[model samples]
Target: MADHTIGTVADIPQGTRKIVVLEGIKIGVFNITGKFYAVKNTCPHQGAPLCEGSITGTILPSPPGEYVWGRDNEILRCPWHGWEFDITNGKSHYNPHQCFVKTYEVSIEEEEIDTVTVDTYPVNVEHGKVIVTV
Candidate 1:
C-alpha cells in the first residue's frame, strides 16, 4: 500500500470530484465543501462507475408529513440504480455494514511554505496537493 499524488486541489473544485486510476483501479477524490475524500469508483452494486454518479444530499428520517434534507453534497448516488453512499466513509446508506464501497484515506500537503528537516538539513516547502492512500 502506498500514497498516490493523484492531482492538485485545483483539479477537484468544491462540490466536485476527480477520478484517478491507480494500479489499474479507479478511485475518486471528491471535494465536499472544502474537505477532500477518496472512494472506490466502482459501486458495490452492479459494478457501476460510482464516482461518475451525482453528488448530493439525501433525505433524512423525519416525522410523518414533514420532510428534512440533510447531508448536503455529502452523499454519492450510483447512477445505475440510485444507491446512495456516504462519500466520506464509503458506507452505503442502504446497508452500511453489509454493502459498501471501498474508501481510502485522503490528505493534502500543508498549504503554507515550511521547512522540512531531513537528516538535520532544511529543505524547500511542499505545495498543497491532494493525495490518496490506497
Candidate 2:
C-alpha cells in the first residue's frame, strides 16, 4: 500500500462530496455524518461524476425469519442514471454481482487526512474532513 497526504479535515463538510485527483485517477471523497469514505468519481452506468449525485439512505432486507428492517445511509446515487452504490463497500445496490467501484483505504494522523492506494486510489479522513490523494 502507498500513502499520500491530501488535505486537512476541515476541507470537507459532512454529507457533501468532493472530487480529487489521485495518482492521475479521479476519486470521489465523501464526508457523511462525520465519517469518511472514498470511491471512484465516475459512475459506471453513464460515466457521470458521482460526486455530484445525491446522498441518501438505503433499506436492506432483514435476515430470513426476522421481521425487522435494516437501514444504511451511506449510499450515493448517480446523477445521470440514478444508480445507487454503497459507499462502505463500493458495490452497486442494484446489481451486486457484477457492479463495483474502486474503494480506497483511509486513515487519520495528527488531524491530517491520509489516503492509501490499492491498485486504484487512496483516500482518508482527518479532523472530520475527507481527503483523496492520487
Candidate 3:
C-alpha cells in the first residue's frame, strides 16, 4: 500500500468532497464536520462517478406516515442511477451486506516530512496535506 497526497484541507471545505486520481484510480475525498473520509468514485451499481454526486442527506425510516431527514451531508448519491451510499463507509443504503462501493483510508499530515515516496520515487511535499492510502 502507498499514500498519495490528494489536496489540502482548504481544498475541500466542510460538508464537501474533492475528486482525486491516484494511479489512475479515481477516489472521492470528503470532509464532514471537520473530519476527513474517502471512497472510490466508482459506483458499484454501474460504475458511475459516485463522488461527483450530491453531498446531501437522506430520508430516514419513520412511522407509517412519517418521514425523517437525517445524516446531513454524509450521503453520496450516484448521479447515473440515484444509488445512495454513506460517504463515511461507502456502504450502499439499499443493501449494506452485498452492495457497496470501495472505500479508502484518509489521513491528515501535519508533520514536517523529508520526502513523499509515491509509487517508487520520492516527491517533495509540504505538511498539512490530505493523503489517501491505497
Candidate 4:
C-alpha cells in the first residue's frame, strides 16, 4: 500500500480514463464527471487488462418493453469478454457481491485555496490533475 501521484485531473476528461503503472502493477484511474476513482487494471475474469476496455453506462428496463440507459460514463466493459464493472466501486454488474474487481483508494491533491460549488456542495480545487494511490 503506497501513494503514487499518477496524474492530474485534466489529463483525463470527464468521459475518459487513464492508466498508471505503480510498482509494476497496472491501475486504472477514471474521471467520472469531475470525481476520480481508481481500480486495479487486471480484470478478475481471465486477467484481462481492464483499463483498456470501453467506458459506458448501464441499460435497464424502466417498464415492460421500455429500456433506459443511466449512469453514463460510469461503467467499464472489458474488451476481451465484455464483462461490465462499475467504475465507481469496481463491482461486477453480474455478481457484484461475490465476484468483483479490486478497487483502490484514490485521492485528489487539490489546491486548497480554491473551491467550486457542485450542485449545492463545494468541490475542492483539483489543480487540473488526478492522483491515485495503490
Candidate 5:
C-alpha cells in the first residue's frame, strides 16, 4: 500500500479521531492515548459510515445481574446497527475473525537532531513534529 501523510500528531488529540479521504476512499485515523490507528470508513455489516459512529467503551457482564463498562474510546460502535468494532485492528466484537472491517497500518515519522551530552556521547533526540503516515 502507498503511504499517505494524514497529518501531524498535534492535529489529532489524545482522545479523538480524524477522517481522511484517500483516492475516494474514506479512512478513519484515531488517536487513543497517543497511539494512532486507521480503519476503513465503511462498516462491514451494511455499508454505513463507520468512522462517524460513536467511540465508546465495551459493556461487560460483571456478575449474574451486573454489567460494567471499560476500555473507553477503544471501541467503535456502528451508528446504524450498534455493531462494536475494535479500532486497533478492526475486529468485530461478534465474529472476531469471521466478520470484520478493514484496517490500515499507521506509522509515525519522527525527525532526529544530534546533540552532545556531558559525557561527550552523541545523542539523537526526537523533534517536536510527528508525521502520521498511513
Candidate 6:
C-alpha cells in the first residue's frame, strides 16, 4: 500500500474543502465535524472541480401527510450539471450505479494527517499543507 502524509487536522476547517494535486490526480480534502475525507476532485457528471462546488444539505423524501425537513447533510454538487455526490461515500445521487471518484484512507497521527492509497503513492501533511508523492 502507498502511504502519504496529507496535512494537519487544522489545515482544513470544518465544512470546508481544499484541493491537492498528487501524481497528476486532483484530490479534494474535506473536513467535517473534525474528521477528514479525501476524494477525487473532479465530478463524475461534468468533470467539474468538486472542491469548487457548493456545500449544502441533501433533500430526502419525507413521510406522507406530515412534512419533515431533512437534516443538513453535507454534499458536493457538480458546478456544470448540478450532479450531487456524497462526500463520505463518493456515490453519485443521480446515478447510483456508477462512481467516478475514488476515496483514500485518512488517518491522524499526533498533529499530522496521512492519506493512504492502495498503490504505493506517498502522501503526508506538514505545516498545515498536504504533500502528495507520485
| Candidate 4 global TM-score | 0.78
The better-scoring model by TM-score among 1 and 5 is: 1
- Model 4 per-residue lDDT tens digits across residues 52-117: 999999987598788899989889999899999999998999888987888888888874566676
Q: Of the candidates numbered 4 and 6, which has the greater TM-score value?
A: 4
Better of 2 and 4 by lDDT: 4
By TM-score, the better pick of 1 and 2 is 1
Error of 5 at 2 (Å): 1.2
In model 2, pairs of residues that clash are 22-134, 23-134
- TM-scores vs. true structure, each candidate: 0.80, 0.69, 0.79, 0.78, 0.78, 0.72
The residue pairs found clashing in candidate 6 are 2-120, 4-123, 4-124, 5-123, 5-124, 5-125, 6-124, 6-125, 7-125
* Model 6 lDDT per residue over 22-98, tens place: 87889888887787878898876667887687777675777777665442446777777788777777877777677
- Which parts of model 5 have CA positions greater than 4 angstroms off? 111-134
TM-score pick, better of 1 and 3: 1
In candidate 1, position 69 carries an lDDT of 99
Cα lDDT for residue 104, candidate 2: 87
Error of 2 at 79 (Å): 0.5
Q: Which ten residues in a row have the lowest lDDT in candidate 2?
A: 64-73
On TM-score, the candidate that comes out on top is: 1
Clashing pairs in 5: none
Q: Write the per-residue lDDT of candidate 2 for residues 1-134, one digit (tens) a residue.
A: 67877776678787776788888888888887778888988888778988678888776677787665343458888998899998878999989779988888776668735687668668899999989898
Model 6, position 25, has a per-residue lDDT of 86
Q: What lDDT would candidate 6 get against the real structure? A: 0.76
Better of 1 and 2 by lDDT: 1
Candidate 6 wrong stretches, greater than 4 Å: 65-67, 71-73, 112-134
